[model samples]
Target: MADMNFTGPEPDLNELLAARPQLGLHAQDGLCLENVPLNAIADQYGTPVWVYGAQTMRARFAALRDAFAAETVPMHIHYAVKANDHLAILNLFHEQGAGADVVSIGEFLRATKAGIAARDIVYSGVGKSEAELETALSAGIGQINAESAEEVDMISAIAARLGVVANIALRMNPDVDAGTHAKITTGLAENKFGIAAADIPALYARASGLPGVRVAGIAMHIGSQILSTEPYRHAYGKGAEMVRALREAGQSVEVLDLGGGLGIGYQDGPGLSPAAFAAMVRQATNGLGVKLMMEPGRYLVGPAGLLLASVILRKQTGKRFLVLDAAMNDLMRPAMYEAWHGILPVDAAAFQGMATPADVVGPICESADQFAKDRILPDLRPGARVALLDAGAYGAVMSSAYNARPRAAAVLVDHGGFELITRRQEPEALWDGEIVPGA
Candidate 1:
């Protein structure tokens, strides 16, 4: 939503959410973010936890899906498992008829466990192990997007060994820049992600000769957090061209997978709208004649959740610094990409007026753990709660307990509002497998 077309004039989270209140995600019970402060949530669910609004997830899926459905391109929304792997969130998307783009065997198992059909799950990753492959095969996964020629042959061999024909697609690099955060870009030629587009023909020829291998389609993942549709159109157009070529060469290509890099609102304008993004895909691949597939992780869940942390210490050294109990280990994007996230007091009652310019920081040893630098905030005090906005995507999914600290808990807010989803990791589990040599 915050016009990512430009670099200057960056909008923060407060401004972003205010513009798209619908995306702010309210509970089915009418619990809106504006009315419920996360501090109270932290107090109830404990600190360093994730909270999601079920209503938000459902709405996002509908908005994005409806936009693409207007055209003939059959859009398949595969929720990216890496975004936020909470089973509850995954189940919510599943109820909305969303498939999963799983990258690991564990994710595959989890998806099936949550009652998602294995036929709806698509295995996609650059570095999948033999066990992971077998797991997916045994589970009857619909298709596997092989990133390398070797993987294509290997999977075919596995499928042959198992006496089954495998559905496969080549993940091709379109050699286009997604113009997003570099940490997330996956489709560039310089990156070690997908197969190059130029070699698609040769690879198809080779794959055609492989036994028990069905080259079902082609896929292109330019990057993550893409705010523009130009890059998607470019990548999709190439995929369309490849599909045409493959069919001419007597290869059966039935699906066209456009990798998900859709970003949600992080700072303040409305985060990238799925409806707008979907329209672009429909126009680009309207008559491709193959089932259109998209794997969106962040855009579906990022706006539905928040990371609730407690203010630990407030220090001033000619500048106000508010330290929090949660650190980079809890939410790593802000430190990793220098990303922007909205910080709100847990108490909406305290937000009636402007306060002071303070840095909302975490207790991580690294100085980069700071959430916001030199941003005006309320006069935060110890024990006060602050809500980290748009944490629904990579927030808790990428979390680590690096500093010997326990992991946080997760809660779900539905019509009933705020039910515990996952319990925070306790210190006992940090050393649960440790041995003291028969002490």
Candidate 2:
């Protein structure tokens, strides 16, 4: 069995807030996200709500774009929709001149519905169904990143049936470890993601022959939460070599889709800076005139949002447990990835109290629903609220209706105001489509 890697020591609230400038605290307002006090949000919208900063997303997008532009690298950013599929978020990116990187038909449709042109959306996934391929081709998507030879053939047949040319990039597995968790790594040889690097050349040749396929270029995504740039240096360096070799072999490779796994500072630690990342890209793909593209998901939104939860009760049975009304069903990253998210009290007075180590848990029945264990936090009384920081990416998108717990509401905040984008799921909505036997 593979060894598990856990998060290191948690950072204090001050450090966490300092790392994320979008969040602020006030004497009277307590915690404020992008000019709107979170306590006000909790009072009006109730707890277990997701709050996102629109201005933060816009700023991050511009920062990434400017970084690549500063190095004079022709890069196109396709927002990875799977990270946060909310239409409001998608529309925000689209408004910022970003494209969409979708993995399924549903995401594809969402992107289109959010005013993103079909020509600006790239379809990528390991296991796309025939129906999905047909839909993408029919919609005239910009490109389809074929992950396997089987998928290459599948796209060919589907595009031929639709009488359209399917733009494609062969997603190559570079066999490089991204130095991230085992569950999220994709570039390794053992992972079931992209096609093997050796297999790409032959598959590219095969794809060119299909009447319905246009071989655009290559694509790769090593893993998620990648901190260091060395793995990318190795992967993109190899990718550059492959492009040169393929061009020598008479392939017209016009695009290099460097799929995104750029990490965020979840623990208030330093993350890979956009400038540093762009510098690496400049060096790795230098003089390779192909148009560069990236599919960033978390890096743009991870630090721009958080989860708001209220304390339900404080259980003291030999050990202290801070039970919250929000459970794994609302934000599953902790329960799913053993992920670390800084928890901050929503009251100014709470921060003044003495800190103690306690288990921060949720209302979920399973023991795995715990968020933090033996973590130092200030005394939080019942009815007090806390914000789970750095939860913007995989928080609400991964939520479930487990234990009949309704999914939480989502809000988008801007300059001194907030708007509820997604309403809290009604309890009856969970079984809206279910039918009793013989009813």
RMSD of 2: 1.7
Q: Please name the candidate that would achieve the greatest TM-score relative to the true structure.
A: 2
Model 2: pairs clashing at backbone N, Cα or C within 3 Å: none
What's the lDDT for residue 19 in model 1? 56
Query: Per-residue lDDT tens digits of candidate 2, residues 90-126?
Result: 9999999999999999999999999999999999999
> How far is 270's C-alpha from truth in model 2 (Å)?
2.8
TM-score of 1: 0.93
lDDT of 1 by residue, 335-433 (tens): 888777777665544455567778888877887787887776777789877777778888887888888889889888777456788987878999998
| Full-model lDDT, candidate 1 | 0.79
- Of candidate 1, the 10-residue stretch with the lowest lDDT total is 22-31
